[model samples]
Target: MSIRLGLQIPNFSYGIPVADLFPAVKAQAREAEAAGFDTVLLMDHFYQLPGLGAPDEPMLEAYTALGALAQATERVQLSTLVTGNTYRNPTLLAKTITTLDVVSAGRAILGIGAGWFELEHQQLGFDFGTFTERFEKLEEALQIVVPMLHGERPTFSGKWYRTESAINEPRYRDHIPIMLGGSGEKKTFRFAARYADHLNIIADIDLLPGKLDVLRQRCAEIDRDPATLETSVLLTVILDGYGAPSDIGEARSGRAVSGSPEQVADEIKRRVLDVGIDGIILNLPTHGYTPDVITKIGEALRPLVDA
Candidate 1:
């Protein structure tokens, strides 16, 4: 499915009581849906990232939050922007998404990546292997995940994981869309070329055009149409009234879009969509899901995707 315009709720620190956290999260998702956003994304991390806040800050479990979101909202799609593959067994993770699919009436999308957060692994007892190991594990994990999502009982023996004829029952749809997020050219692009339904590029803004080109080349090498795999980018946005901050789009070494809602939408079209990426996923890390801002963005940006 094409994720034309998506909202990513990367921060849950709304200064509310712990009991009210899910409501606050739902407010944003609902607002985004009203604003015409097609998908709602949550980060799949146990701890806050260094760029957003201290690791000890409030971070809800992603799938649980998504399950809750599924009950609370009607139409918007639900998923993690990209789950760290090292966090769960391939089989169980497949089961979880299947359950989410049945529960949400086929709204779940599996977005995964090679694990990157070392501290989470160190503290949580998951093996924090080298970069190579993580990708290998992700590769092996997909072998089980893809088949199971398609209603197959896959039995595989690999360097990292082995599944003994795993089965996922009660599927709402046979083909749950797979989106891979990362910037690694060799592994991520190749695997995405072969496997993913969408590719959410996690990289600097200036780097996107090149990434798109490489992605196209990768698809060509696989004898697949590049357009067949939808593409998007993850960006942070901070608005200054209805205009851009002077340093807007100055996010190569560092990344973010600080602008008025109209400007940010225009910049996305010019910088991202014009550069050939299919869609955009935005994160309002600093603003914490302000409703008006989300709506304004939706009103200004949705047409671009629809057009």
Candidate 2:
């Protein structure tokens, strides 16, 4: 999966009425594809996130939205940035992605991790367990999901998940790329070394070089080439219409940066790519879902990472 540049549509409130919601979503995706983004992503949650908006804000179900996106576009890869493992049964999640692959002609990416978002779990009736338990659940989930994505029928019983010969038919390819998104070295990095095709670093930028080194060690210990697993970082940027910044100091927090396309790209090159990360995923958080914003950001970002 050579997705060096990705666009994440995390907000659904387009200031339009409900009937025009999905039409707007499809339009942004098509524009991004034309503007040179390699992948398209959405958040996997029932409610809007805390920093973004109210709990009742409009948010589409990830798979359903991706399915609609599949019919609307031809080339851009579609996925959630990371799926919440607790939201669905492991076997069912595997089936959904495979079905997506069949529909999109093999452009689905299974981006999953230990489920976060406590309020969503409480309101939605999914169990919100301790951190260790969530990782344990993620570990068992991969046991079932990995093989099924490979078109295998294996019976496995674990404390968290049990599958009796789960088989996913009509698979578009022998493998759908699995991207594990998080910065937990003990659980997420180890799992990535073993199972993931992409590791999206979600931690602070200054600490990333150390994390990358640790990930290399994790790969080496497991007898896997560090280079085999691809990497990307998620950045929150407030883009200007033109590719220049109003003020760049607001981005010092390192995780979320604010700037125009050029400023954001320079920061990404300095912090993420120069530190040996491969790709970049941008979240506009507020001003996204507009065609011109998507096109302008992609125009500056695609070449920076592609270089």
Give the TM-score of each candidate: 0.95, 0.94
Task: Please provide, for model 1 over 78-160, each residue's C-alpha lDDT reduced to its tens digit, 9 standing for 90 to 100.
Answer: 88988999999999899999999989999999999998998899998989899999999999999999999999999999998
The positional error of residue 66 in candidate 1, measured at the CA in angstroms, is 0.3
Best by TM-score: 1
lDDT against true structure, model 2: 0.87
With candidate 2 superimposed using the best TM-score fit, by how many Å does residue 118's alpha carbon deviate from the native? 1.1
The number of clashing residue pairs in each candidate reads 3, 0
Cα RMSD to native, each candidate?
Answer: 2.4, 2.6
**Colliding pairs, model 1:** 242-260, 243-260, 244-259
Candidates' C-alpha lDDT: 0.88, 0.87
Number of clashes found in candidate 1 = 3
